[model samples]
Target: MKDLKDLTAIKLKAYTPVKSIRTSWNVPISDFARLTHNPIRAIVEGLKIVPNPDKQLIALSIGDPTTFGNLKPAPEVVEAVRRVIEDGSSNGYGPSNGFLEAREAVAEYVAHQGAVTPNDVILCSGCSCSLDLCISALAGAGQNILVPKPGFSIYRTLAEGFGVECRYYDLMPEQNWEVDLSQLETLIDGNTAALIITNPSNPCGSVFSKSHLKAIINIAEKHFLPIIADEIYEHFVFPGYEFHSVSSLSEKVPVLSCGGLTKRFLVPGWRMGWIIIHDRDNHFRDVRKGLANLSARILGANTMVQGALPDILRNTPTAFYDDLVSTLYRHAEIAYKSIKQIRGLRPIMPGGAMYMMIGIEIERYPEYETDLDFVQALIAEQSVFCLPGQCFEYPNYMRIVLTVPEEMITEACKRLTEFCEKHYKMDDRIILQQQNGLLARMNQY
Candidate 1:
């Protein structure tokens, strides 16, 4: 028996040394598919195998406020949900567009942005789902939508999945992340369906100025395209900046404004969001009908949440909102200052939103090859997680969410500082090479 066991162990070791499972299997795969799942989550999952002994893992990757379980939703909002459950009438499927009251509630909430009515509103599970409906309805196969670079990945993912081309336009980081209107105009053609822009821009975190917004609207009008406004981060701007509803600003081109209770209200779990059509000239008659058709297929946002929408929109105290904005402002400043202090990282101080895009001086860290590699190494060495810029179609940069607790953010920054100090190098040649490489990538993109 002992001799047999030894022989078995020898055979197992020999088998391990040889490559196993090399069979060709025909599996169905879609050419249009892209990993649209949160790339931030993907990074965190990949780093789970790396052992970290010195520091506890501090994840600032996800933008979910509820993840920490500290930031509470409004008392009024909670009461509304409680009342919804007690009433028990909201359990059934809502209207295909949304509950009438909920649609009317959303329409009134953003009524400041021109005239909006219940007929102009369509609800969905979340802002993301709302986007999916909008883009899918607007663009068919072989059509294209112009998206902002260093923006959310979902735009590309959703468009590609729907067999629509993803056209990217650059945002000037030096100019408070405003759109390069010239570049934007050049990307427009007959097949272009719409222009999508995120105010209080994601990844960059720079809010569009009123002038910038007008310029974008003008460009959209000139090219005869509608606007898809991702204003989920609306009203989260800091003291110096103000949130402008694109629908409120545009008079000619129709604006499909998307927003939810996720960011400002801190009720992401409710999964309630809406799209309000602002067609001053009724340019989106067909588009609105298409949106209705799309909404019918998916039903609508949570009926119970829809029941609470009235209170969530109207009754949440103004003080709660002030406090929320104050909290975000403080954290953004802290993150900005911390990244500024770090030797090899250059961050564009965000004026809005809960993110700051920090640029990695690749030449300063020769040990790492790319931003993705740098982020993976940071996770392995310090157990700190942040999203790489490549996930947003840019490289050598990282997007950090400032929604976490102050102490955790500070600790993560400390770990990042130490990581950079440990891997710091001085090489000008590497910078030129990286610049050339980035140029090549941009050209290809």
Candidate 2:
């Protein structure tokens, strides 16, 4: 044997690279872990990566309202945008807070909810951007924010990226997906900065009742945390349910009410959304300043969307909104009926929005180990592409978009039932093993 030091040197030299790269970049990506788990993007990419050629893909993957033929913006709304472009009104830079008229329109719109005014509004690109701004403005790194579970993933994503802690409270499915107030209270602490509420919720489509909204306001008031109400689906109520804005519920708690022209007006690509600082007694000046600073950093939302907003708000016919709601109600009815007949799937009838969640009896499917496995198998065999419940941070369920054509809903449900029949058998041991494995994975995380 060689000398001990010489032997160590020889071992190190054996692993030399063919080439070397040099750089001064020392900071690691702070948000890399959170960014990698964007389910929508991951699912889209997964579809592209699959080598199989015979996949019958019916994408109920994302919540884009325009895919089904709903109302496009009115002709007058389009003309307003065209006029702004032709006149070069939006060709140059605009105020960081947004155009005065656009902000005024947002203010007036929020005013209709009860107590908000134009002075409270700040326009941003969309609700996503508004949420980011609000999170950044109000909370710094290592602080905590409360979010609803089986809810919008963006709130968790944004909070994590900013190094803010995200604490989740349950939206109990048994109780029509209402926010669990006791859970909310337990999740809040001294470092908590804000609480988020999504009216006409995205995944569940459950609208909060007036009594529930008031109770939420009381919770916020007791905690001294500002409320971030995402109302993008505000007016998309079904036949029997009515939409309530959080600003309408209280004059006591400070609310950062966010809404967009995307879902209700059917113009998502337009990219115009607003954040209104609803402080009835002038208590949120610091929060307002923080928002202003954030807006200043990013500049304003799109000028073209901003320019047309006044007309979009004022001139869009009431008939258009009424018809849109009626169409959605009909689609919801069709989808609900279809889902009800399917074996091993349970759907709570949605009251608002264009999506519904269906609980999957994992025990019913012997081959499925989790909701993701069930969804993947469904896509491979039946060509149906519903979102797995785990994608929305809820396991043992899947979400279906009701925006598909009425005929497609019937066909999709039929395929789903057949798929379940083909794969599932009433085998107790297999299900217990799968559940044990799933529970182990959950506990590990």
Best by lDDT: 1
Q: For residues 1-445, what per-residue lDDT tens digits would candidate 1 score against the true structure?
A: 9999999999999887765564887565676554345544455466544637777888777878778865788899899999999999799998888989988898888887889899999999989889999998899888999999988988876887777888999998778788888998999989999999899888888888888899899988887899999999988889988888898888799899999888888888778888888887878899888998899887777899998888889999999988888887898888888879888889998888888898898878888888888988888899988888888888999888888888888888888889888998867787799999999999997
- lDDT per residue (tens digit) for residues 118-232 in model 2: 6678899887888888888888887999888898888877777677887888999999999889888999899998999998998999999999999988999987888888888
Residues forming the 10-long window of minimal summed lDDT in candidate 1: 35-44
Clash count in backbone of candidate 2: 0
Cα deviation at 56, candidate 2, in Å, is: 4.1
TM-score, each model?
0.87, 0.86
Off by over 4 Å in 1: 1-51, 428-445
**Number of the top TM-score candidate:** 1
Whole-model Cα lDDT of every candidate shown, in order: 0.85, 0.82
Candidate 2 clashing pairs? Answer: none
Query: What total of clashing residue pairs does each candidate reach?
Result: 0, 0
